[model samples]
Target: MENMIKKIVDADNEAKAMEESALKEKEELAKKIDEETQKIYDSYMKDALETVKRNDSLEEKKAEKLWEEIQNKQKSAHIKLQSDYEQNCDKWVDAIVSRTLDTNS
Candidate 1:
C-alpha cells in the first residue's frame, strides 16, 4: 500500500510538469507570432507611406506645370492689353484736341 501511494504521487508530479512545459511552449509561440505580425504590419505601413509620397510628388509637379502655363497666358494677355491701349490712346487724344479747336473757332 505504501508503494502504491508513492507511485500515485510520482504520476501527479509528472503530469504537473508536463502541463507547465506545455504552457511555456504556448507562451513562446505567442511571442513569436506577435513579433512576426508586427514585422508584417510595419512593412506594409512603410510601403503605403512611400506610395503616398510618390503620389504627392507627382501631383505637385503637375500643379506646378499648370500654374506656370496659367501665369504665362495671363502675362501674354496683359501685354496685349497694354499694347492695344498705347496704340489707341493717341487717336483718342487727337480726336479730343480737334473737337476742342473746332468748338473754339
Candidate 2:
C-alpha cells in the first residue's frame, strides 16, 4: 500500500509540472502575438503617412501651377494697359504740337 501511495504522489507531481510548463508557454505565446500586432500597426501607420505625404505633394504642385498661371495672366494684362497708355499719350502730344504751331503762325 505504501508503494501504491508513492506512485500516486509521483503522478501528481508530474501533472503539476506539466501545468506549470503549459502556463509558461501560454504567456510566451501571448507576448509574441502582442509584439507581432505592434509591428503590423507600425507598418500600417508608416504606409498611411507615406500616402498622405504623396497627396500633399501633388496638391502643392497643382497649387503652384495655378499660381503661375494667374501671374502670367496679370503680366499680360499689365502689358496691354501699358500699350494703351502709350498710344493715348502719343495722340495727346501730337495734338498739342499742332496747336502750338497753329498759334505761332
Candidate 3:
C-alpha cells in the first residue's frame, strides 16, 4: 500500500508539471500571434494611404485637363463670332445705303 501511494503521487506531480508547461507555451504563442497581427494591420494602413494619394493626384490631373479644354473651346467660339461679324458687315452697309437712296428719289 505504501509503494502504491508513492507511485500515484509521483504520477500526479508529473501530470501537473506537464499542464504548467502547456500553459506557458500557450501564452507565448498568443503573444507572438498578437505581434504578427499588429504588423499586418500597420502594413495594410500604409498601403491604403498610398493608394488614396495616388488616386487624388490622378483626379487633379483630370480636372486640369478638363479646364484647359473648356478654355480652348471658349477661345474658338470667340474667334468664330468675330469672323462672322466681319464677313457680314459689308453686305449690311450696302443694303442700307441702297434702300436710303431709293427712298429719297
Candidate 4:
C-alpha cells in the first residue's frame, strides 16, 4: 500500500510540472504575437508617411508651376498696356486740343 501511494504522489507531481510548462509556453506565444503585431503596425505607418510626403512634393511642384504661369501672364498684359499707351498718347492729345478749341469757337 505504501508503494502504491508513492507512485500516485509521483504521478501527481509530474502532472503539475507539465501544467506549469504548458502555461509558460502559452505566455511566451502571446508575447511573441504582440511583438509581431507591433512590428507590422510600425511598418504600415512608415509607408503611409512616405506616401504622404511624396504626394505633398508633387502638389508643391504643381502649385509653383501654376504661380509662374500666372506671373508670366501678368507681365505680358502689363507690357501690352504700356505699348498701347505709348502708341495712342499723341493722337489722344491732338483730338482733345481740337475739341476744346472748336467748342470755344
Winner on TM-score between 2 and 3 is: 2
**Model 3 alpha-carbon drift over 4 Å, by segment:** 86-105
Candidate 3 clash pair list: none
Error (Å) of candidate 2 at residue 4 is 3.0
Question: Better model by TM-score, 1 or 3?
Answer: 1
Per TM-score, the best of the predicted structures is: 1
Query: Which tens-of-lDDT digit does each residue in 1-105 have in candidate 2?
Result: 999999999999999999999999999999999999999999999999999999999999999999999999999999999998887988888899999999999
Who is ahead in lDDT, 2 or 3? 2
- Candidate 2 global TM-score: 0.75
> Please, what is the TM-score per model?
0.79, 0.75, 0.68, 0.78
How displaced is residue 18 in candidate 3, in Å?
Answer: 1.6
Question: Which stretches of candidate 4 lie above 4 Å from their native place?
Answer: 92-105
Model 4: per-residue lDDT, tens digit, 16-93?
Answer: 999999999999999999999999999999999999999999999999999999999999999999999899989989
Tens-digit lDDT track of model 1 for 1-105: 999999999999999999999999999999999999999999999999999999999999999999999999999999999999899999989999999999999
Who is ahead in lDDT, 2 or 4?
4
Ranking by TM-score: 1, 4, 2, 3
Listed per model in order, the count of residue pairs whose N, CA or C atoms clash below 3 Å is: 0, 0, 0, 0
Name the TM-score of candidate 3.
0.68
lDDT for position 18 in model 3:
97
Tell me the lDDT of model 4 at 91.
Answer: 91
* Candidate 3 local lDDT, 15-97, one digit each (tens): 99999999999999999999999999999999999999999999999999999999999999999988987998898899999
In candidate 2, position 85 carries an lDDT of: 82
TM-score (C-alpha) between model 4 and the true structure: 0.78
